[model samples]
Target chain A: MDEIRIFAPATVANLSCGFDVLGCCLDTVGDEMLIKKNDLGEVRITKLTGQDLPLETDQNVAGVAAKSLLGELGSKQGFDIEIYKKIKAGSGIGSSAASSAGVVFAINKLVGEPFSPEQLIPFAMEGERLASGNAHADNVAPALLGGFSLVKSYDPLEVISLPSPAELRMVVLHPLIEIKTKDSRSIIKQNVSLKKAISQWGNLGAFVSALYTEDYALLGRSLQDEVVEPIRSILIPYFDDLKQVAMDKGALGFGISGSGPSVFALCKGNDIAQNVKTAINEFYKAKAIDFELHLSEINTEGIKILE
Target chain B: MDEIRIFAPATVANLSCGFDVLGCCLDTVGDEMLIKKNDLGEVRITKLTGQDLPLETDQNVAGVAAKSLLGELGSKQGFDIEIYKKIKAGSGIGSSAASSAGVVFAINKLVGEPFSPEQLIPFAMEGERLASGNAHADNVAPALLGGFSLVKSYDPLEVISLPSPAELRMVVLHPLIEIKTKDSRSIIKQNVSLKKAISQWGNLGAFVSALYTEDYALLGRSLQDEVVEPIRSILIPYFDDLKQVAMDKGALGFGISGSGPSVFALCKGNDIAQNVKTAINEFYKAKAIDFELHLSEINTEGIKILE
Candidate 1:
């Protein structure tokens, strides 16, 4: 039996103004998978460790993506799979993305890396599809390639990695709650007012411009979300207050991370990061909600194997 | 009278996926202004050098911006203004923006450069305000800065720049018909479907990312307008066919330059530019509409003195 092991990084999706367009990787948290080829011609889950997760590996997002990829190959080999989930699932830290990305990456290496990064996006999106039943690449791209990435097109080869600022330090805060990506997605309106769209695009344009120019102030200004944030924010406790506190603490911007419960704040320096983290923690404490805070630098190098 | 000359470059607003977020400057054609400080204590138009234009200088778009800036300063010194409209008025290639930017630039110089570029954006917005009755800076920023620019916040302070690909060549075609910016803006739906918005944002995200990576193919894939283009495109003759012609001729992408009556195509090389120009010219000849073709580079030097 040939065995392969791979890792994929966590990501923050719905990045402020980017919504479905932007995402970035995070270090120190992700999912690891080990796969070995067998002659059973059936996929089987051998073990699961770290973080309470589902045992039905076929239904598991990362395992599903791996199984789907293997199924598509029409290979007459069964696979033994083990998942070491490090990132807290549904924490809005791209927990599922790390799993999906890791599984696909491990499977690809095990079978000889046949597809390009672009080619793998759809396969990764399949994992996303299993998770949300809707295909999106904002999370998957960053999980695949570390650094700032964009989901330009989603079908017939999704696009990734537009211009990103070199100075990116994102501080994420996860409030105590489990918010499904589907539930968060559902809360959003089916239609958006054109006036709001214009404002949203205006900010998105500024965000993109700031990335190219390294104008941190402009990035701060453009980090506004008038469309999705306002609607979905209702799901998070003390959402508005948290944002105000983070901003008052000198955060460049604040937005709901991925499908919510977890919120991310963008800052300029380590001092700002520390300040934002402290402020966000204080906000949660004031609200009497138990939560966790992750104050790390932007994980420009996404997923990698651990020695 | 102290005569001073100022020039403003043409601009392409709503660059594909950017919609209201992104725009860039075109080097080929623009508007020019000659301002003469006088003791008359009021702005007066001494000459109109372009094609038939509003003779009442006060009502003119450029004149409005210039007058507003002067009014804000409360200067008793009068100014005699001469307008040289090189970029065709009412063409989608940011005709209103050139006037607004040129007048603002000329007035700034005439006033001994009283305000910084940041301060001048609002003044220029005044000109756009006169033209469209709404103050927006998507066109004005690029007209002022030349390369790809963003107005994260339409407020004067939040304007910034994004990266521009070095190999960008713009092929613009005007079919001689005038399309008012106001009318084009009105035709767009005041509401957008959420499904469409996701697709739009996805493309916009890709477009912004493409700028950083200089991925031409991704740029092409992302160059889609589902909301504004579909509704407003009906106004342009052979709009779809022209886009096909330009794309078939090697244009990376094609869309309405600003509003309508004029269209622009983006291509990678000079050879593609030449091919697009010939293709567009043929479209015009086939339709029996007299038209003009422009092969231009992305103008990185926005507003300048043309002697």
Candidate 2:
């Protein structure tokens, strides 16, 4: 009971038209955290692997999130945390969220689950703040709660877990390129025309309805982003071309995942997902760019205990 | 058949967060039209009742819509049209849509229904142009297709019919004050901050999801409209007070319906809808303003043949 291991999955935020609101978890790639009691009464990252992430408790997202949870719990109990990072940093697949959500999820379990999943969001968002300058929960919510999550409001931190269709599959391609979250976010305009905003909201409504009805065609038609994607997609190399190739290959919908360098295409079945992956691989191969492709069913169980 | 009769239900457009994209039909109020063939080879309005709507074909929404449909059908056949309007003009509850949609629906049937319900939208929207000077279909689509409708796109004219919850009921209040569509629209800002747009889109996504899953609580929570309501509600007297009363009386959600003077509240059952209606009536009575209240279930059948 004094030690626990938790795995937090990668997440796709935005989902094209649902910027800053919608996100879903991925089953194939994630981060693992091992938490063990320590005598020093301090929360610390004792070990790290796969990437050169900060070891400092204050600087690390996992540490920050754990510290926030501990601060709320008013517990001085010490813990040594080991992070086995599988989701790559700057891959735009919610790497920081996996870390932040992983620690709090593990800590909550170790402490007999004092906080509900919704209650755990602010703590994870605090960790997200350490990783990125903004305290946003689009990625962390899904990574912590499993399946699709909507950050309906951030001020009071209202997160809703949405239903995931059984037939849904995802094809994510990480282009092995780094795109700083802050830089990608800074490029977006502060104001948008009311016209485009209306169009975006309409698409978002249709997209959410499609998810509930399991109407894949409607979902595909609603996967458009006329606002954020148009501006942010310019930062990614061949984003337009990649999206076209994915759609032409029968992806129900495709768009930049999170902030970019990683793009995801959703499909109805595994065969189409494989086809999309191959098409994307062929495109990247033609350009001789190293890329990683992960084909997965939606991770309905966002973070889970590791046996 | 030498003649045909059709009824087009009234609709509530701009369902809060969905502004200009979402709408639903009402069962209790609508417009009725009768079309009879003649040898004159001309479309003419032979009779009008309930309201003094424009009789000239170009000036009338119903007449304009009928002409648009007939032009597409390449039918030179003459027709005498009779209109019996029950939905009040400038009520902000798709009065024009009921008229416009009624004629197109009647003519489509009289000519053997050459257009699918969806295909009839543009012609109906053409009718909408005669009324609003803009070819918008938020009201017309729902009036034609029944139930709830989302105008997903306007360029290629994509309209989606959303599933309406069986328990959903509506209470619409017309305050007898006129707010011109142009004036109401002119009051809104052309641009909105990205922050507000994100919140609006999130609510929109949640609202649509709620409709499909029949999650009444979620639907109520998602009925917020920070973008348009804040600006337009100022035009309606006691709008804030009426909305508060409706919510207090167990209405799921309340907001200005389209360009106001009229406001609608959604409730889970007929009893709550009646309670909301009584509350609204009390509010108007206190102010000594003449008002009309209509309580009804959502019209699942938008336009229907009058037997």
Candidate 3:
């Protein structure tokens, strides 16, 4: 196949209790990308719409990601790419991850599928590096592998995909604001108390078990972040009020998605998610803020073919 | 049910990568107890053998645990307890936990079981509180619930029992040296770098997943301790050498069991465990250290009825 059209789904990273190690895919929100092979021996972003991003190969997450994959294989195979962005940049819902993971996924398919979905992760992570200062796997991993993904280790780059409960729904709230990855990360302390660290790991362990057992309440109880959230949540507008409302609306758990500007309320079923979305809307609407709400089921499949 | 004789299996707590929250029950290393209902409305220790311990109900761990269970139930029923101590007190394995969990287990059985085995955890933890200053449930939870247990929280006191692979075995090396839990704990820094904490939680999250999947190799990789081991291992003699030989001889993972003096090497099968045990034995014998070694399978039944 010389050309491939695909849907690169959005992802929620920096999960509560899980912090930098866990992420889950979103089904309803994503960007559409079209890639076609070119014999010119060059990677280029020929078309870009919906959001104004750089067209330079090195500057664009997709271009960087696609080049990483091609460079790894030593293939002179070039590709012309077009990204129709639906998920806005700096929304903190893995905007760059979608474009990055999406391009590598599409190119791998175009090049006779030399790499499996899981194998495409490292190249996708290059996009993450270009987007965020760190080459963290949390966002790109779940975006490629789908479901709930755990980054077991970083040196080896081992990521394990966990099974998501059938009824799990994510209600995402994005306020029209930008939180730069650098500035957002700067506020967090370099050190944490061991007491809080123990609590975080215990909750993280229980949270993983909850995923296996599909214990919704247990999952909610384990969705606590003792390390980063207390400091970073202040950067987002009304983070506390939103979390309180989400929990009161019977969300299984709630936390800042990635670094912030986007928040997710994890619910057991679509009905509760819809209710959470409605409650969050009504609560946030009262404030002088423009926000968007999305209710989505856990995406079992990561990226998908559009045509 | 007037007279009950039981085997209270020992447990390995403060597992690698797990630290304060994880533990597993052992099959062969434990203590035997004979508990009998008394006509007098008072708890008493009629006989104690194999070790010098306090006989007073309040001073004895078994007595404290038994009393805690009775006090919670508000039952006037009393019992005469006999403990034949086998597991050494400061061996890092759950010695106090065995005695503490055993009597409550036996008394519960004698009184037609007012509480389930899992319910007996809190009372058993009272014994832990008497033995140590903290009422940590890592040891006692597994001593009651069997197999592997994760102490999800200390405040609300939630414990989760996890599965163990069929062939899993533990080779425990109790070097004939005593290191008090308080002294062992003091050396660890109350604060840790965020980078190390992230690595710890990442490994812990993966370790929990490994338990569910019964992936032994993955379990080996996940058995890492960045926060506690470096400081604590200094308390144990030739700690690095022993771990090296155990790993070289094909043990799945190795680390300090609970605190110090006693270390455990986790192996996948009986054959590998035996090999690891032999290697460790040989390594320790050359040194001027006197040690006792025990090889045990994962005890799915925490406390057993011997007769």
Q: Clashes per prediction?
A: 2, 1, 0
Which docking band does candidate 1 fall into? medium
Evaluation by TM-score, superior candidate among 2 and 3: 3
TM-score of chain A of each: 0.92, 0.98, 0.99
Q: What is the DockQ of candidate 1?
A: 0.62
lDDT of 2 by residue, A1-307 (tens): 9999888899999999889999999998998889998989998899999899999999999899999999998999889999999999999999999999988888888889989988999999998898879988999999988889988877666787888898899999998889988888999998999999999988888887777778898889888998989888887788989989999989999998999879999998988888999998988888867888899899988898998
Which residue ranges in model 3 land beyond 4 Å of their true spot?
A: none
| Per-residue lDDT of model 1, residues A96-174, tens digit only | 7887777777677777787666566667778788888787888888877777776655555565554446656777878
Q: Write the per-residue lDDT of candidate 2 for residues B1-307, one digit (tens) a residue.
A: 9898888799999999898899999999888888898899888888889997888877888788888999988899888899998888888999888888888888888788789999989998887787777788999999999999998888767888888999999999999888878778888999999999999988888788788778898889889888989988888889889989999999999998988879999999988888888988888888967888999899989988888
Best by TM-score: 3
lDDT of 1 by residue, B1-307 (tens): 2777877788988876777767899887877778888887877777777767786766787778877888788877777878888888888888878888877777787778888776777878887888777787878889887788766665434766667788889888888887788888888888998767767777776677677778777777778988888988899889899998998998999988777677889888888889889878877788877887888888888988876
Clashing pairs in 2: A146-A302
Query: Candidate 1: lDDT of B21?
Result: 66
User: Considering every candidate listed, which one attains the maximal DockQ?
Assistant: 3
Give candidate 2's total backbone clashes. 1
TM-score of chain B of each: 0.94, 0.98, 0.98
